[model samples]
Target: MRRTQLLAGSALLLIAAPVSAETLKDALLKAYNTNPTLTAERANVRAIDENVPIARADGRPALNLTGGYSEALLQGPGTNSINSPDRRTNADTQLTVPIFTGGAVRNSIRAAETRVDAGRFGLRGAESDLFTAVVGAYMDVIRDEAIVGLNTQNVRVLDVNLQASNDRFQVGDLTRTDVAQSQARLALARAQLQTAQARLISSRENYIRLVGDEPGVLDTPPPVPGTPAGVDQAVEVALQDNPSLLAAQRSRDATAFDINVARASRSPRVGVVLGAGYFNYLGSLGAGSGVDVGSQSGTTGTAGLSLTLPLFQGGRPAAQIRQAQARRSQSIEQVTEAERAVVANTRAAYAVWKSSEQVIASAETAVSANRLSLEGVRAENSVGNRTILDILNAEQELLNSQVTLVTARRDSYVARFALQAAMGRAEADDLGLEGGALYNPVTNYDRVKNRWSDRGRDVDPQPVATRTNESKPQGSEVTRPLDPILDTPVDRDAVNAPSKRP
Candidate 1:
């Protein structure tokens, strides 16, 4: 008996324990660490870093080796033609060191390095865009869940109203029309509940797709920090710090370097060439011939300076220079385009965030007034001064306002996050993601930019992102309950008291 009592007490404790909810920070951290799009962008930046080493190779020393062996198939016809050696083998090694290439190699290396910087900025922009999407998905689930709860509660309340209307009709106190009206409203509320549940399921699926796991109970997200004071401030900050704009500017600078690289092609190049050779007659030299050959093996070496001047390049160099100049011009215009887009996006996000704030305030007031109106309608119906339809309409108005309030809160939060993202302040570092050190693209660029070893290579890549295929299917469960204020009861005497109308 004591064991049974202890087991029962343990079960009770388990039931009372609260489940630890997932926070916005936790979700953002998961996305940051495992998102596939962001992972691919990091790889692309690493690839760009390799271009620097490739350009440097053009100015580095190169060595080559060649070897050949032959057994005379048929001795070249001719006597006194001192038949050539019946067997022969030879080997040669050469080294070429570039001394000058105008400025082609130098300017090409500079362009590649500049592009690496641009790629890193592009990676930052991708990170910020990903975080914004995650935030929107998170808020979507919260809003839809609340809407489902509200609709569920409405269905239950309407069902109760329908039963009461039926009771009144049986006693002849209410007409059959009154009972039918409650029945119709109840049906509509159930339909709305189904719609709300469907929307919630979609939101949960999207959350799983991004977060890499089925969402458990998600806590209310904390307010986004560091919102701009106004649209002008937001645009000012974005122009200075936005990743997209910075990347465009860097790309333009790199293109300017490309023009120099193209022009360098027209200049003279100089280099040094050194070579060594060995030959072996394989004991067959002068065999059976009256000629004596001393020592059938020999070695030789040579070194000299080489120069190349392009007298004419078939007009290729001129065309290349022109092409590069055109590209630079395009890049200049693109920088301006990026600036325009940043200003427009920042201002729009700011306006939406501000408007959402106003809508939230108005919705809160509407919810309060509608709740009081619902209570008054119920009191009037109890005294035969209001029809059943009046109560149904009041309930619906209250539900509308409640739903509006939920949606406005969601919009406000998401807009604020969007605003921050537009201003280049919504990356992992800005959010202070806690589990690990943030990925530093510069670490990779620095590692590979000057690499000289041919045998050097990074380890093979394994997937960093988690997969969600095996997780349980998402359901339409509501994580948050409807507001309790909706249930506040008003005194019948106060509701029925005559109003002092002006």
Candidate 2:
């Protein structure tokens, strides 16, 4: 039973070597360059780009060319007939242009443009999610690697202790029971070391899946940038910049235009129609007629303005309007929900990050105290004031404390990344990933917005500019009314509050 306690308390305790190693930025860059999910979202944004041209086409002119040919036969009891066999051909060219639709086309274009804006924000949200995932996976690999090392050392140390106990038992200086205890502890340590190694392997596999490559000798991640000064400040920044909330806000704006589109159905539609046609008829004249007719041909042209007033449509337009209004309301509620979720998540992450700092500090102090205790316990054992078991227990305590410290450090780093994500800053550009590509939805939107051809651009314009979320420093300051009320200087104490029970 005590051996079980020993094994449980003495988990893996490892210190990573300080050397030239793979940085967190490198892993992040790898994920950013090749993540399939990010690539798919970028494609989704481009698909949204088509909505603009489709809406614009509604207000453009359309023309058609038509032609037909026919042959006919007529017979009348072997006598000359006025109606005889004949062949004819006809052709026409017609054009129609929309003059007005009570602003339907214009509003539709507005709605589509708004959706495109929302889609851009959606893409940004996806980017933040991807980066966050990469950060977690990278940390897991490092943590597991450290655990495996500690376990390996534990097994080795236990084996040496078991050998010493066996020699003492042979000399009758230690009991057989003591030797058995050492053997049991050694065996358990070996088993745990195996388990730790397996977990490391699993963590490496997950790292490969997310980061697009196996992890090398990974270095400890550097401190994340732009941590909020306080939890309240984090909430404020998130309300302003969280991509999900921004996306929801833009979605509400898009639905506002839907109301106009639905209402436009009740108004008059005006258009212009122009048509020209040519016809030819050929036959032999078999009766006495006023005019000779070997062949006849004529051309005709017509132009008119068309108007369609919807006097009534079985209340369909009114029903559509109601539906649009309901959707707009739904969008408004979604924005509110998004804001709430962002605030809750930001506060939660801030609390965790703030508390992890204290946990790490306490664990470090515990490790130091435990180390000193172990040294004194070993000195006592050499003077016959302590037993071999006492020394082993002291060492186990030291190792356990070291394990706790490592865990606390890992949690602190992960929480910091989480805090960054919550504040809408865990993006490649914000993280300063080097030599990675950033997908700019605006560049793709601008490329295809005005395209008139069915076949798209032969070559897309390359996005040469760097993408970032920060506002330009040189721009004239425009302050929102709520900013003065909500903005506060960074409070380190608020940002680093005590941890709470879950």
* lDDT, candidate 2, 44-134, per-residue tens: 8888988999999889998889999876565557544345535668899999999999989999999999999899889888888888888
Per-candidate TM-score against the hidden true structure: 0.90, 0.81
CA lDDT, candidate 2, residue 123? 85
| Global lDDT scores for all candidate models | 0.84, 0.72
For model 1, name the residue pairs that clash: none
Ten contiguous residues minimizing lDDT sum, candidate 1? 9-18
The 10 consecutive residues of candidate 2 with the worst lDDT sum are 477-486
Candidate 1, residue 419: lDDT: 88
lDDT of 1 by residue, 128-209 (tens): 9999989999999988987887776677667667766776677666788988998999999999999999999988898888
Model 1, stretches more than 4 Å misplaced? 1-19, 79-84, 483-502
| Number of the predicted model whose lDDT against the real structure is largest | 1
